[model samples]
Target: MAKLHLIKLSVGTETIESLRQWQAGKQTQTADGLPRHVTRMWPKRADELLDGGSIFWVFQGMVQCRQRLLRFDEVIGQDGIRRCAFVLDPAIIPTTNALKRPFQGWRYLQPADAPADLPAHRQTEDELPASLSAALADIGVL
Candidate 1:
């Protein structure tokens, strides 16, 4: 059983290249004296998420890239609150553009509902401007 993992559209990440740099820089946050990307509220279906799930990042009103789930850890923050640390594989796999309404926090994504990974040959879209990409998508040219 796979589960969905979601991240808010990054405020600073406008392009995939920028996201790659951001992600490279995002990996070293300290959690419980160790490095991890932890979020509040441990997911109830951690097993399913760890089984075979990717954290889908929402970008520019659409679901974009993903990082594979590796493991989960419990961390106690400086405020003495416990959070779920999602240890993820560093690879970011791009996905087909799929529109999504804005929402708070991470949400579970069922496998059937997850966007398909973009094909390797269809990588040219990354070179286009966001608006041009959107226009091409709207015109079925992407």
Candidate 2:
């Protein structure tokens, strides 16, 4: 296990199920290296991010799912800014819901702080309403 990555989803694209669909769709496209996301800056800990790390996705302001980090590359934007292109594997692993505040950029997710992956049989709850799940997790009753 290695340190992970955390990213806030853009508005209207926050559901864990939606994330799974997105990952699936991306895989259907020709394998263009790895699935990439544009970011303002490249992570300094690229080695750590690629070392058996997963990207914890914050959906609807809560942690929902993760994807393995295949790699990260630097991409220069049209405006000449060097940006990070996070290359992620297509598999979206569900995780127990965890609350997170809105943030401007992706952050490092320590292995210890990242939520445990939901077991295959337990992934049914992934479709539950975020509010209900968050409340349950808050009380340690989820």
Best by lDDT: 2
Worst 10 residues of 1 by lDDT: 26-35
User: How many clashes (backbone atoms < 3 Å, residues ≥3 apart in a chain or on different chains) does model 2 have?
Assistant: 0
Error of 1 at 124 (Å): 6.3
lDDT of 2 at 27: 36
TM-score per prediction, in order, is 0.78, 0.84
How big is the positional error of residue 5 in model 1, measured in Å on the Cα after superposition? 4.6
Show the colliding residue pairs in model 1.
4-109
Model 1 bad stretches (over 4 Å): 1-8, 26-36, 135-142
lDDT, model 2: 0.73
lDDT of 2 by residue, 1-142 (tens): 6755555554446686665555456532325845556678778888887888888888776787888888777776689888777777877788877878888877888898988888899877537787887787788774
Candidate 1, 61: how far from true, in Å?
0.7
